[model samples]
Target: MQRYKCTISYDGTLFSGYQVQPQKRTVQSEIEEALKKLHKGSPIRITASGRTDAGVHARGQVIHFDSPLHIPEDKWVNALHSLLPDDIAVKKVEKAAPDFHARFDATGKEYRYFVRLSNYKDPFTRHYQFQYGYPLDIKQMKAAADYLVGTHDFTSFCSAKTEVEDRVRTILRVGIEMSREQLMFRFVGDGFLYNMVRILVGTLLETGRGLHQPEDMKTILAGKDRSLAGKTAAAHGLYLWEVFY
Candidate 1:
């Protein structure tokens, strides 16, 4: 058997989430179904770099699976493309080391969130961007984001539903960019806890809206209390932008 790595993109609007669930559609279920069909009755399971919640999208999600077939890498992409649903696209396929794991081997990840700046809801982007019409102070947001950089315990930013005990993670960078139509928040980190990115975005947004001072981020981080953070941002606006190996 050989291990193959595939970089994929998906429109998660219709997916229950990335993981398989009983009687519900998911990204993993769809890809595994396609692989099972390709194997002509044999089952194949894929390991993704991480999971995305419902309505969250991905532009560069990575997964790895073991297969006995000898098909060329390009053909693997074509084969999976023909079998997957229209919402999912296999962007690239390549042979990987036998011991390489999509999740455990990942070095870092980048996530991006988009927010609509205007009150006029564009039907075209409703599923892709979070609609937030309130005035936001970009400078204040940036100032608040600065405190998030570097290694720190992020219990305050994580969702209470998360079971992971290690709340410490390193954030390489945090960027806030705005255009006439929308604002984009970018986060590059070693790893993230459940809902960490969404919570971070929500907190920064609150700072931008004058609900909190820019320096309040430091206090929140020190508090390590989830309730001290802002509301969790909508999942639809978030994207798993990339996984760094």
Candidate 2:
């Protein structure tokens, strides 16, 4: 058997999420079903770098799967593409190191969130970005994000549904950029809890809207209470931008 590491891009608008479900379509289920078909009904499972919630997209998501078939790396991509749906595409596939694991060996990840700064939503980007209409103060948001750049217990930013109790994680960077129509929030971190990125963005948005001071981020983090943070931003506006091994 050989392990193949594949990078893929997907539109998650219609899927339940990345994981498999009994009666719902998911990214993993789709890819595994294709693999099983190719393997002549033999079951095949894939391990992804991480899971994305419903309505979240991915630009360069990675996964590794062990296969008994000895297909060429280039042909693997073509074979999978033929059987996969239009929303998901395998970008590249190659034999991976024997010990490599898609999720376990990951060193870092980067997530991006988009919010439009317009009075009305654009037809082309309505599904891709949040339509926040209000003016945002980038300076205040930046100041708030600065406090999130180091290692800390992020209990406040995680979702209540998360079962992981070790809330400490390291954040490498938090940055924001503006275009003609929207604002982009980028987060590079060692790891993130469930809904952490969305919650962090929501908190920063409050600061940008003058509802909270920049220094309030420090207090929020120190409090370690989810209720003290801002609302969880919509999942549709977020993307799994990259993963580092």
Going through the candidates in order, what is the number of backbone clashes in each? 0, 0
Q: What tens digits encode model 2's per-residue C-alpha lDDT throughout 76-192?
A: 888999999999999989899888899999999999999988897589887789889888889999999999999999998999888998999999999899989789999999999
| Candidate 1 clashes between residue pairs 3 or more apart in a chain or in different chains | none
Local distance difference test scores for all models: 0.96, 0.93
Measured with C-alpha atoms, the lDDT of residue 33 in candidate 1 is 97
In model 1, where do residues sit more than 4 Å from their true spots? Answer: none
- Candidate 2, clashing residue pairs? none
lDDT winner:
1
Model 2 bad stretches (over 4 Å): none
| Cα lDDT of model 1 by residue, 1-245, tens digit | 99999999999999999999999999999999999999998999999999999999999999999999999998988999999999999999999999999999999999999999888979999999999988999999999999999999999999988899999999999999988878999999999999999999999989989998988989999999999999999999999999999
The per-prediction CA RMSD against the true structure, in angstroms, equals: 0.6, 0.9
CA lDDT for candidate 1: 0.96
